[model samples]
Target chain A: MERILYGDNQFFAVNHLSDSKSQALAVRFKDNEAIIRTLDHAREAGINTFMCTTHDRIAQICDIIRANPEKYKDFKIYPCMPYAHKYANAMTDLGIAGTIKQYVPGNLFGTMFKGGKAFISKDYVSIMELLIDAEMKMFKGIKTPVIFLQNVMTDLLLGLGMVDLLKGYHDYIITKYNAEPGYITMNMPKLLDTLEAAGISNPIICASINKVNFRMSGGKEIYEETLRTRKFRAIAMQVLAGGAIPPKEAIEYVSGLPNVESILFGASSKANIQNTVSTINNFDSNKV
Target chain B: MAVRVALIGAGKMGISHLSILGANSNVEVVGVCDTSKLVLGALQKYTQFPCYTNHSKMLDQAKPDAVVIAVPTKFHYDFVKDALSRNIHVFAEKPFCLHPEQSAELTALAESKNLVNQVGYHNKFVGTFQEVKRLVKEGHIGEVQHFEGEAYGPVVIKKKADTWRSDPSEGGGCLMDYASHVIDLINDILSPVKEAHGTILKTIYSSQVDDAVYSLLKLESGASGLLSVNWSDETYRKMSTSMTILGSKGKIISDANELKVFFKDQKCPQGYSKGWNVKYVTDLAGQVDFYLRGEEYSSQMDYFINTVTGESPNTINNFKSAWITDKAIATIKKSAKNQY
Candidate 1:
């Protein structure tokens, strides 16, 4: 993981704070070139790692990267699977078979039947794998050092005691993609314990790490204690706590943590990217 | 002289062609494109040839003399058309495309470019089927009156409701994958199917698409036939294709291995008076360099290679025949009576 990883939430119009800003963003980044241009800006700011959800638009972004390999040779992507909104919208628009036809790979019906059955039977582990493969299809030839299970499914599994699935996902990333597995969750502490219980140690877990207890299950104290003592690679996200904390204070609090490995943030402009990068870097320099 | 070929779709058939086409010294497997990184990554351990997951991206780089499409029948048009637009030749799998209009457009494009196009109706070159064609042409069967082509298999048995072979959108189902060969065989011997009336069943095995398709086809040569195929037939050992043809004078029974003819004192090829004459596939007149999947797969590639180099003319399941197959299938769909 890079010290500062660029996120795709801003590009996809996912504002944790305001609906108006998100709507503006949806209009703003509707053109894929706008997303690509912002990604280039992030690259210029020395943020080479793009932590993104596997939305349909990301396919276009992958195409841009693949088409111009010279420009993106050293770049890496952390592709998160089961972009829930995309699938939910697809199900609404195209219906069940149509959604499966669009997502499932290889033998459409053979794989889809399993996926559909898994959904009904709550054998979500197999469905997760299929969804991963389906999601991984877009970034086929691109460099993806880490593939993530998005929070919508990841936390659901966490809440459901589906630890076997966590292990399965972990194993698949290593075996199929030859990449590290990442899990994003709301309750990082519980997820870590489940993963550790399931034989996945020193895992990469992305969650809300901030000054306030904004969406931080188990509270800020527990998060701080886990950061200090846990044997895991912690990628801090939602550090600004949906704009509750000031930028400087958020960066300072998260950067000064004991075991946080990486900071994931999203920005629409060059200034915000530079500011975040500089703030984190300045905090690190001042720590000594 | 090597014919540079880029193969798209690294499914089971793609892998088969990869090994077979690689075995060909006269052809270069320039690039292999599939949507699966696992498949492409797996290919890297063996061959140093270029591999990609996107066809257009691969085409931009490979720029080969020809393209081979071993993808599902649904994707035939786009990949084939992409290659044809570049004035490059293409060889696609059966059921040329999902629709007649697209098939006509691709056929016209390929023809306008004068690019060699072949579809993988490997049964056409199967020795027994070839013999059946030969026997029919020689008037041994004597003006075929009707034929029944049946393709039953365990491929989609037990409601294989979730494979590309079972999805209607993906150009799956028993008819597209299995029955197309028998249809093409009838077309090869008699004439193209001009129209069809049929019933397609999706609920027999609870498939997303039709698991079983039964149809009566009207041939251009004024012959009519029945096609009974069900992918969900679990009684079969595996896949078995058998065609029974009844003619004015005699009849022919053909399967994968044996060609049987029962003559009513018809044209006997210096064999006997009036009885059943059966010849196995080993009695075929030609030999292949190598046999993978079937001799026809290699023969098809070899023929395509030879055609590319001007060694042979484009024959055996060209795109026009594929177009007719496409039209016939569309007609079957349009003609099937609603069960509601």
Candidate 2:
């Protein structure tokens, strides 16, 4: 299946989104007409299926898969869950808890998941407990996919052991339930060490690019080093801040670098998609 | 459908406007004028539009429907007044004038002309900021109480000791270049500050310009705001333009990219409760439905052109709003002298 290749996880995230702000499968299904347009554009640009959320829109995505069985059959969906109720319901009914409920302590969006896939957040209050319950339920048929996404501010928070439970919990999930997790990392050099010490391997690490605070050189160097260390399987990219980098230049800039597997780009319109596609397609690796 | 647009001043900001306007569909760069032949000559290659050293000549030949004034702050009043008197819509860059009184006159002139006018406050168009505004309006953070904004970056100085940014006489300083953004954001998100006390750090980087400024603003809605602007950072060339709004129910923190809202209901650890909460939202449809169709230049130009055509609402980036920013700058300068 060529591993159903993608440039980055955000490709999946964006595929799940209607554009950038529509709710996932649990809230509204088949409502994100724009997201379908974007995914179609991505497919035209030579990408296959990626992991994303359907939220309350899960059934709509199912319909999409049913409608175009070959096109979207390989899509990897990861729905987000913030609390116990969402997790519990996902295990059984596969729908998230309604929005008005008092989400479980440490559960961020327990109110949003109507249920389907267990999208476990590392920032949740009782991440360990939530992961344990979610994993147990997923073994019975639910899908629990965890993501570690944070920047410097959250990194400072996680460094204080706020995410330690996640570290231990990830190990337990991958080893016991065959869970495959992913992390969107900032300061790739630093986080690579953390992943190594914990013996965590299944989770893919994405190094976000920040032109000001975290330069591309540092990120690029760390990615190359990690590739050599055999600590990471793939590297996804993100922008820690917003700046106008022409899509063509940005893709050309990263595509030539060593150990870069994918990039998470945010596009506001279809023109951006065309420009970005043209840029990605224009990469000449031999020139590097 | 092309709205003829004229470029005035032909400076760095003017060049940026020209480049972006060139890519817009509804806008056509009809003419560019500047005093310096050097500036005009350099810009000619970037535009197929006519170039003239005189604004009046360019305006006469180009007969532009709109004009973008990107000259120094001192020339803003005269240039804007000239553009508006010609019945042309005006788009001027910030710190509209060197003084509040001057900006007040320009504002009045704009009103009399009744043509579309917008300031180059492009930060408001950013996706995350729009998200913040949406979240705040939706009461995602509850009742607003206090807000704080800060824009910090390393000081820009001249390698040759004669950079225009170092000249205080020409609207060159930390407050003029940067503090306006802080004040604009504060005023836009909250109401204009009713009163403020501020302090500008002088000679932190060099004796040429003040290194930083801090302001304590009192908003018209009784909300308090703390604004800080620093041009000098001992570390790297990183900017952290952040804002936090503390409301009655919860708080929303704008961490540059993400608008994190900490709700009252989410249970937190025994120690770290009621600070900041992260909810992973995966939605692309709503945002992309609007974003995926337009060119960057057209998005902004369309907004400006529609404002001029009266087909869309005229954006409120007038001189009246700029006075609030000028007042904040004055407070910082005054506090710098007192240093209490």
Candidate 3:
């Protein structure tokens, strides 16, 4: 796991802090070149991995990376699956069958047949795998050492008690994509228990781990206890807690935690990226 | 004792409610009802809760203390009425009913039965919006003179096949689906829109229904504002609802995620400064037992379930408030018809 992972939120205008800021970012990264520039800045700032959602625009990013294989040979992307809006918009544009035919990666007829079978038999796991394949299509020929299931689907499955689907995602990613499966969830304690019950040992989980307990479902103390007592790899995200905490304080808090193998953050500027990287490195060195 | 709850519709929002209800320690999901055999089969296979195709059958057998209705807006009237008449607490999804009259009737029925009724305008549960309400009420942004409520999303960027969301009769369109949220937030955070004029329901993408809604509104407090909402905005990754209120003393800008307030002088609320003060949803939002898309989603369900269990007062997001929103929607629709 990379010690620092750059997230895609800022590039995609997913500002959890201010709408105006999000609008600014949306304008700033309206072009794909701007996003590429920011990635290059992060790479120069000593970050190697980019954790991003499988938005349609990301497909273009993947194409750019594939084109410049020499420049980004060691650059890795941890692709998160089921960029939900793409499917939702597609579902509205095309019906269920149409969406499946459009996105699922295979012969059109075979994909349709599989979709039909899954629908009829209620084989949700199969459908899940098909959707995974479809979402993974964009990351083809890229270095995705770890694949993540976005929290929207992960927490939903957790709430539904559908741990089998989680396990299915885990095993399928390993066997098919040959990447370690990571679960991004708001409820880390419950997800850990579910993963344990599903026999997914030492799973990689990413969640909001901040000093303020922002978006930490079961609260900060529980997360701290789980990190101390658990065996799984943890990736601390939202360390700044939607800009509520100062960067240094936030990174210090996350770095002081046990079993946190990586810290995930997003910034659009070179200065912010360098500052965050240095802060994390400083906190980590102090801990060591 | 736990509140025995049954769910109807079992669509996207319905399943979300069912999941939250399933996780609530104060509630037990007694039955699930939906017309789709596929959805019911999946539920039956995975969950221990009983599943039924007929809502009436589910209601009769489950004998729930409360029921959640998440069907299409057009069906909300019938389903909610049935649940209310059964002396069951009801939590129905938003755009409470297709027409204001139906919403009024349901509101009356629920009130007469003394049953707990809630409409899922989940934005009210958003912490930043809640803080907006507080700041406005506490006169941090004194005397809101003008305001603007806007919501945009990429739900329908292209000319698409007709779904329930594309049909106006089914309570689709930007007016009902998107603008209603902003209207409700304006009503809750500031004041109810008393009148609307210069309304324009433009069909940018959808053939049958309006894709964007623009109007000038007058609140009950005589403060006026603008309403601009479009569902065809591809720039937004999802629905982004925001409100900007300009006042005599200060100003406020809020969205689902954050709240920003500008006070002119030192006469500001505690923990807030004279100049620009910003608060994020993470700082304002309360924790929930189970979380999905956002804390607001689970928080709304938790509030409804708590109200059903009599643990909390049925104050916020009641049917009456939703009726106010429906009336505002009707005002906009009627005003749109008179556009030049």
A255-277 per-residue lDDT for model 2 (tens digits): 65555555555453566656665
Model 1, runs deviating above 4 Å: A1-288, B198-202, B271-273
Tell me the docking grade of candidate 2.
incorrect
Tens-place lDDT digits, model 1, residues A1-288: 789999998887676543345558888988998999899889998899999988888998899899998989999999988787655433322344555556665674465355533232233344557778878999988989998998866764554344666788899899999999999876788788879998888999998888876556656788899988889999999898766678999999998999899999998999998999999999989986
Pairs of residues clashing in candidate 3: none
Per model, how many backbone clashes are there?
7, 43, 0
TM-score of each: 0.54, 0.52, 0.95
Best by TM-score: 3
For model 2, the superposed segments whose C-alpha errors exceed 4 Å read A1-288, B137-139, B155-160, B234-238, B266-299
Once fitted onto the true fold, the runs of candidate 3 whose alpha carbons sit more than 4 angstroms away are A89-102, A105-122, B338-340
Q: In model 3, what is the error at residue A83, expressed in angstroms?
A: 1.1
Error of 2 at B187 (Å): 0.6
Per-model DockQ against the true two-chain complex: 0.01, 0.02, 0.50
Tens-digit per-residue lDDT, B154-272, candidate 3:
88888866878888899888899889999999999888989999999998878889988999999999999999998889878778899999999999888888778899999888989
Interface RMSD for each predicted structure: 27.0, 25.7, 2.8
Q: Provide the fnat value for model 2, as a fraction from 0 to 1.
A: 0.01
Worst 10 residues of 2 chain B by lDDT: B283-292
* Cα misplacement distance, residue B132 of candidate 1 (Å): 1.1
Steric clash count of candidate 3: 0
